[model samples]
Target: PFDSYRDAASTAPGTLPSPAAVGDLLGEAGVGSDDTIVAYDDTHGVFAARFVLTALAYGHEDVKLLDGDFSSWRQEYETTDEVPPVEPTDYVINTLADDAPIVDREAVEAAIDSGGTTLLDTRNEEEYEQRHLPGAIRLDWMELVDEETRGVKSGDAVETLLADRGIPTDRETPMILYCNTSRRLSHTFVVLRSLGFTDVAVYEGSMTEWLDADGATEAAD
Candidate 1:
């Protein structure tokens, strides 16, 4: 279901969908603009966070995330793969949120040029070895997730982990997170925000767009 939702919501690979598309997505799901949205996924809430971030970008204020994931839910309750029928509504997009925590290619380039923002690469080691943005810190998004719970680690634990990597923990520290498609990076965005990282942002058009636009990259050492 999420796979279908994602495909329908996206305009292009590694890009956020238009606000109108998001409105349609919610409407088709029988969700209203002001309704409470609880998002979850099978993959340790990565895709759920992606949806939550997308909703937030469109000024949806009541979005919530399920702790853990569908597997976690199954462990506690009965499970079913049945798709429920729904009546679509007219969910209209009024206005996009101001100063949304998302960055484009040009903004990412400017951040790099300014040498002020921390660029974090949330991909696997093999992917990093193949190619990554110059000066991007390598931190697999899984590193912040608890394997047992399949949820984000505690805020204190995240702080310690980030400090171990020489990353700033101050709320004002500017950090830009990215993965190949920006989906995995959304989980990291939520985790960092929970720790009061006010200036953190996701590069929605991440490595995919970067490579397409001829942005330079470096292989791992």
Candidate 2:
């Protein structure tokens, strides 16, 4: 189910999953529209951020990510591998949220052309050195994470990191983020949003769609 958010029917790489796909998963889990959805994972909430952001974009109003992940939970309480049964509902998303932080290839291209948005590449050094979208400053998402707990760093810590990288902290500065399939960028998206960034967007198609469309790229030595 890790890839449940991907559009299986689409031939396009990095396609966003349909609302029905998301709804079906939530429906089977008996998730209600108004229910508070909390997400967490062992991978430092990087994976959890994907679900949190996706659910929010699909108009689930109260999605949240646990500050600490399963590792932190297991140390404090009992663990469970048991799956609980629940009544399913006909969950459906009527519309995407107006403030959904998603952008398409065209939008990324336009941003690149206009130089109006700060573009961040969330891939690691190897992938970035190979190829990356034009004008993208390499920002490994883990840079904003705490090495000890593998959790997101404090806001002040994040601010310092951003400032060191020369990234703008202005709330109105338009920013676009991307990784191979947006999985990595999801974490960055949430962190930036928490810092009160209002105009942040994720290139859901990410590098996959960019490569498919022959989008121009830059490389580092």
Candidate 3:
């Protein structure tokens, strides 16, 4: 289904909804635990990826984004107002995995201090040059996905990009990724995992919380 008001099993704009709230919305939307969800959005994979990540946080697995998104779908097929049949399921969130997909500000800072975790900054070049976390491997979110159609780029495209930049290619490396709201970073997180990169976490606090906490930032020379 297209990314619409109905697709949002959570609150809108700026930040993610609470775990209980997301479970409630998804449960009512008839998303079962065993089901596979393909979330897509017109605003790029930004919102689409976020929805999948949120589902994972609430203990829902087997979800993925429609790689090309709704724009690609519309380009090929006629639109319809008909809605799919939905069976409401009482989806209670299972306890989170021991290795959660998210990390907090303090955890990130500690990781940076210890040099055990790498930070992948997913903001734009302008913002990256203006200010960024020290030692963050800069990668603008737009590069991972298309600008016009908002569809995700191919995995080979990203692999080549990372390799050309001399970025680390190890799968077991610990990494924390972030964007303005951590929304865009989710896309990269998924792509990296698909390429076999492990121990990746999304810093949901992101730059917004970093600034709020008066964390240190570095600028381009």
Candidate 4:
């Protein structure tokens, strides 16, 4: 009801907690592996993505990203501006890499060095210009939600967007998305998936951890 993860979740809205804290939160909430945990955000899916990855890392299964997210929902649906009671349910913990869809800094560096993946940054132009991962492509997710374009274009439109950025939409091309964190990337992930991009995944820690790493390299366009 607060419409803010920070207000409701007792943590920074777009930040990931320690692994132990993640486990404790899920356990205390009685979430089970089979439970459907839907995470979303008002802006890009970055916050939702971080939450998803944390859930997965903490061994929670059946997690999903809410399409269009809170902004789109508010535009299309009437929402109450009050906090609602949460019903705790038992969720089983099940961590599976293939199903979870996450990568670390080392994996990201290796992917870039080996030309094994395309890194997509969903942050805004200013953020992208400030600093970014080496060999990363900037594709602001907010632009895709344009009112004129209606929040998602056809497959052809997606193709055009990728082509303009010199990116191929081939299924075999591994695409890894990131932002300050994964919240915005989550929405981007859903959009890419809807546009028929199958090999898309997200980097969990993103630029925050990347910049903090002892020997991380940055493209800094």
Candidate 5:
């Protein structure tokens, strides 16, 4: 079955599905332990990570994230107007990770005030224009990987992207990335870690919680 979180969210009225529900949904969709599953979202990889973690929790293996996400896929590859059909298979449910990978509003507030770190916002320009956490710089995720932005032909693409944004890559500075929901941010996390960024972590709840709060610091330009 071609299950979508967006669809579930609309019907269920929640940001995420319960772990058991996710397992049941995937199982009903026939997702098997051996299946090579890929999950993605346009906002950020937080949602994808949830799904991946859910699959792993339910004992499913062979899961991988789609590089660059759906938008990037469309930009890189041409597709036809017609939709394609999908086949469903049984999936085994295995749960992993005791807690959700989410950092709360208070943690973000502390992180911003403490300094000694670079706060990167991976949302698009339009979203950044609406609002963002205080001291967070908009780094638009696509710009990081685009050949035109950094123009570097080789080594450590993530570092090159950060450097292009005037962020130093030395290990001394801690780096934290966040987005509306952290789906794209997860991809950023993966890229940065691969490029040897040692002190990096993602703000899981991200701007969603910050913006929803009563008096959290938020700015718009």
Candidate 6:
């Protein structure tokens, strides 16, 4: 779902499959609030991040991403096409708006207007060079990840990466991260949260929505 666009449902690309459409996908597959889930994607954490956020939103507290994702797992283990046996659970979610680290376009705009956020452009250098939101500091999402393994680098390495970029790591100075969309940004969001950043948010609508709304952008020199 790269370069995804919004639909009538306000979801990226298409609407989420209805509860009936999947027909007990969660219940039959045995997903529950107490489950510690591990999500992964072929392309970095692009797709996995969404599942991580969704799981957390439903009050599933221990969601994690497969570092380097499926690729990394392949290096350490064998493949299996056969599905694992699912232990069903009667878990009912209390969809309370959000339990994930997400923010909308309006909140991002307000943060920018108030100069209250250290905005990080988590897209590639090429994208950032083409055009980026005003005041966004470029930091490619992959920089914090191990190229071969696709796994995120250590916390010490992450701290150094941010420090080198002059990105604030303090609790008070809020930070907002974004990419062309937000998949890449979501990876960084998780890493930061793990590092004890409590005031971080991701602009899920990101550059796509920002540009759609005629938001201001600037190109690299």
Question: For model 2, where is the 10-residue window of minimal lDDT?
Answer: 7-16
Clashes of 6: 2
**In candidate 5, residue 1 scores what lDDT?**
26
Tens-digit lDDT track for model 5 on 57-137?
345556655554556567767856895654555543344344333355676677888877688888898888777777787
Q: Which stretches of candidate 2 lie over 4 Å from their true place?
A: none
Q: What is the C-alpha lDDT profile of model 4 across 1-221, one tens digit per residue? A: 11322212423234445454554466566665567888776644555755665665455657876655677788778988797656555434333435657677788888988996788999998888877788888898776665542345556767788889877778678899988756677667767766677788777667776777754545463
Q: lDDT tens digits, residues 50-116, model 2?
A: 9888898898879888876899778788999998989998898766788888999899999999997
Residues 96-162 of candidate 3 have per-residue lDDT tens digits of 5566697878988898888967788888888899999988888877788766556767778887888
The TM-score of candidate 6 is 0.83
The candidate that wins on TM-score is 2
Please tell me which predicted candidate would have the highest lDDT against the true structure.
Answer: 2
True-structure Cα RMSD, model 2: 1.5
Q: Deviation in angstroms for 84 in model 1?
A: 6.0
Arrange candidates by TM-score, highest first: which order? 2, 1, 3, 6, 4, 5
Per-candidate TM-scores read 0.89, 0.94, 0.88, 0.70, 0.61, 0.83
Candidate 3 total steric clashes: 0
Tell me the tens digit of each residue's lDDT in model 1 across 1-221.
Answer: 44433434454465766667788889999998678999998999988989888888888889877879999888888988899999999988765689678889899999988898999999988998899998898888899989998878888888888889788888999999999887888888887776778998999879978988899999988
Clashes of each: 0, 0, 0, 13, 18, 2
Poorest lDDT segment (10 consecutive residues) of candidate 4: 1-10
Clashes counted in candidate 4 amount to 13
Which is the winner by lDDT between candidate 3 and candidate 5? 3
Alpha-carbon runs more than 4 Å astray in model 6:
1-25, 87-91, 97-99
